[model samples]
Target chain A: MNIRELILNPDNFFKDLSSKESSLTTPFLIVLALSVLNSIYTYYETSIIFNLFPPDMQSKMSIIMIFSIVSSFIGGFISWLLIAGVMHLISMAFKGEGPFKRTLGFIGYGFLPNLIGSLITILVGYYFLSNAQVPTLTMEQLQNPTVAEEVISSIIPKTMVYTNLLINIAVILWNLGLWTYGIKYARDLELKKAFIVALIPVVLFLIYQIYGVIKML
Target chain B: MKKLLIFILFLFFLLLINPINAVEFTGIDYKNEYLEPGKTYDLWVIITPEKEINNTVIGVSPYGVGSEYIQIIKGRDYEGNLLQSEKGVGHFIIHIKEDAPSKDYNILAYCNYTKDGKKYSDNRIFEIPIRGKPTLTVENPSVINEGINRIYIKIKNKGTGIAQNIKIKFEEGNNIYALSEGYIKYLKPGKTGTVEIKVYGENSGIAKLPYTLTYSNPYNDLQLVDKRETESRKSKTITYNYKNQKTVEESGNLIFKIIPNDAIDLNVKDCSFPVGKVNNFTLSIKNNYKDSKFTVIIGKYYIGNNQKTLSINYGEIKNITFNIKVEEMGVKEIPVRIIFGGNEIERNISVNIIGKVDLVLTGVNVEGITEKTITGDLSNIGTDKAKSVLISVKKTERVIPLRPYENYFIGTLNPDDYGSFELHAKVINETDSIPIVIQYRDENNNLIKIEKNISIKNLINPNQSQENNDYIPLIIGILFIVGVLFLLYWNFFKKNKKIIIKNNKNNREV
Candidate 1:
């Protein structure tokens, strides 16, 4: 709050952030590769596989499902680039040479957030496509074959509500872990140091997400 | 160099890759111009595939657009198995119900080509519209009888295709004739031809005119119909007949001319050319046939002096001049007579002949034997000379000599200009050769003027035969011209419109 309190605090915060950056580097890369591959596969499935059911079947879904898929891709790609830029700034603060190459390795591990986010989103995209109802009465699939109620229920159910809630809540947790790992990974910070800085967005996002859930409810 | 080569390779690859999905096949297009319901229409199917292929198959299911609900009963593929699963690539035909709904339908082309006796499905969608069949058109028609009723029944095809087995029948009230009896014909699109039907009075109760057309369009599998009726009121014929009447002639060659006053109607056959009030009538023959009957309206003219009955001839000459002589010394105006049958016209002329006298006075006035007197006369001797007729005044020296022919009284003295005058003269009795002339003198005979030279036929013993005479007609004629000018001024001012002087009315000039 005072000049010394504001200035001395961020220096201590960055010193603690650098100590944990060294510890999350190896584990962050492992998880990032996993999440990336997960997002790539689901991206193909939602773009190609979901649209394959014919336009009449696909047309009736709400834009929330459309936005989530699009934003998931956009947020995934943008998050990778933004996290890398932030890591390069951290490397410049450290006076490290080879900024571009080192910055690549530094926050390339930031894909972990989107990867973890997709693992959760895929479960929801799967549920929505399979359970969404057809808009019109299907004659061939009905009376002659006598399509069962269970079949209709299984084909198109309202899964977007529950899936959206679960994924959004998981995203806040995933993003906090990613930013914390990113700050420390560039500066080579310890778990105890990085964990201290991780509380900032953890508190902010929790407040934001709670407000969103309340409005929707 | 290697990097540039790699960049060029990448650019070429991008161009080739775009060919597979080049055009965006937005949707299928169909119009009623070709296929509308039971009517025919053309459907255009364009597909923008996911990727390019050598050839793409298109299928049209004409119910509406969507997952086509056409029944695919279990059938054998080229491999001859139960064809539930789709083959590699092939085509199919589906029959639409006659009562199919008219709307948009989706066509799915399931290409069936066997790969290891299995079927795969690759489909594209196009919309086909189902509409009603074409409707028939029957036009209101007309029949015209120009040079005998030429009944033109034209069944022109206005539809897209040829109307098959075309037929037209005409029904006039209770009577009807199939077009096959030479009363009907067909016309191709945009052309017209005639059909002639010669008809006689059939039963007298029906109208003699044929008018109507029933057109039919037998399209695809549907039968749609419409009707038209011709309007009424026929045109009738009008005939004309004429009659000729008698013509009355207007007299005189020039319209405003002096015709003989006693002319009457010269009738030839039955008509008369009215030569109104004329003695010399020129008869013109005209043949007028009214109701095909000819007649000479007026016969040729007749002259009493020429011929009694001259036949009617337009260019015939009959010179008819007449003269009748009488013995008289007095001034007599004699007339020549012309008669057309009972019609008589008398033309007058003066035939003055003296029988027992040498002279006669027309204007002579003398009370006693005086010198200043003269007389006018018209004479005829036939053989002998006239007497020395003179006025020997017993107290004066005046002598007036007379000529032996008709003479009007000139002034006793001669004038330089010729005009009417009046004066007095005396006759001189002379037995020998003597100058006998009537002279007018202003007292002393200084300017003596002779009125006439007289020849002495006999030396007379008469003491005096003189008279003072004057021609009073010359004074009366001068007064008549002045009277006419005064009457002209009176008539002009009396009949003319009067003008009021608006300005300076107080100043009047008398």
Candidate 2:
């Protein structure tokens, strides 16, 4: 499916893609491309995110950036296979039939919303955080949780953080809607069954992201 | 009647001719009249008679003046007959007591004898004086020079009495000649006087200038008025002890000390040179006397100058350099003789000629963790050049050197030239410093090894955060995000009309 069709009507896009046999390379490449874009945004985000952290923790930016790249590339491939396997099993339980490759390709294409959302989030982060000042922290100051939180809040603009978080949550919901249609068409299953299959990992990931944000705050 | 006249005439003539009728008092004398307190003296009384005498008696007395000072032994009362016409002599032993006052006393002696049926008597008197003994001391004895040395002699009269008319005389030995008789006219008690006399000596040795002093006791003149007065004389010999009488030699108090240029431990700092190579050795000459000048003679082969004139102060040390070369590989001792003011002292120092190479490590910096590089400047601190210079990190039980590239070959390092090298090493927990070994070849192609240790404690334990990598959780979060994206793509993006149906035994795509 073309980018326009995938963006405007992801359900028909998945339906058109299901007629042809899916290649693992294309799905793998698609996931890798999206993951690489996401990792690039993360690399810059990590640099800004750690600006509110202490200096000692900030030096881990390089290691963290490298891990983002490696994990996204390798983790993308592994997750594609895992998602396809899980969906095929779920659809089979519901008396639905589809090739695992087609399901994987359809799931891979479903990353369109996230890819677009991450680009918008990066742009928004740059706009708000361009002139923002990083806070200076010491090991002693960071050890005291109250002082660390106070310092981080003072340094990171509240509007910028809130705006970035809202954009990320809105983009995630949009991707979930697209994922439900894409799964139904790709797996030849009911909308509810396809929704459960896509929502499980997304909910789990949302909970994890919220947990990391809380811990950092 | 004629015969009776003849007998009377003959007897009168015999009386006139008989020496017994001429029994006259001679004189009284003592062996030592100037007697010291608490000493003895022998007093002799003599008389002459013409004829034989019987029952003769000689008596001596101090006339009550010396009765307490002098104790004279008396003659017996029943003395036998004395010889006729022989000079009659009597000896009296007299002892002067310790409590006797220092003064002169008169001594009297009397003699009674019968000759030709006639009796005669005579008396003699003399005086004796008691005084303190005189002491003569020689002061400022000096060395006697060759050929008539005018030695200035000083004598001190350390006594209560005057040394009257003290005449000193030096003995002329085989090796010495006296030009003037040493004499002192008079010296009052507790007074010192100097008398210079000329003497000669042929050699440089401790020569004994034996001298005698003859002095008369000034109080020896008798205080008696009736008897004869005389003086008592005494003689004493004195020897002078003068050490450090260093006679003339070719080099006087000039000492030589030969050493290498480094003037440290003689054995360790000995200079070395390759065969036929020139090197420098330092020779120091010291004068141990006050204000002395000397000409030191070291041959031209050892040093450039045959002789050097050095005017050094007392205990002054001076140094000179000797440029010497030798052909054979052996140790040679060079003797340096220093001469000054007729005296000399010699010293010998050795120079070694053999192949040698020594390495010194400087400016060492070892940094990093287990995989660390040992970087330092290696210098050749020996007299010879080191070839095939190799610097390596030696492995020990606590340290393991990296394989394949552990050593650096520097090729050659001359004396005092420095080169830098680096080697990789890994240290275990037990190791604190790693030993950097340097191996090289000497001029004779002999392998020499040197090792230096560099501490890595500060390098390894840098003042940084020792925290474990926190990227594991971040990696997990990233994987989860990627997993979610993959799932969304699997469920919604791609379309598949034909679905594979799976039965209990077979699965088919329709």
Number of the top TM-score candidate: 2
TM-score for each model: 0.19, 0.29
How far residue B155's Cα lies from its native spot in candidate 1, in Å, is 64
| lDDT of each residue in B329-358, candidate 2, tens digit only | 667666655565554444456667774566
Candidate 2's displacement at residue B318, Å, is 89
Candidate 1 chain A, poorest ten consecutive residues by summed lDDT = A1-10
Clashes of 1: 63
Give the docking tier of candidate 1.
Answer: incorrect
Please identify model 1 stretches exceeding 4 Å from their true place.
A1-74, A84-106, A113-117, A136-182, A188-193, A196-217, B1-510
| i-RMS, each model, one decimal | 78.0, 13.9
Model 2 misplacement above 4 A = A49-61, A72-82, A209-217, B1-510
Q: Could you tell me the fnat of model 2?
A: 0.00
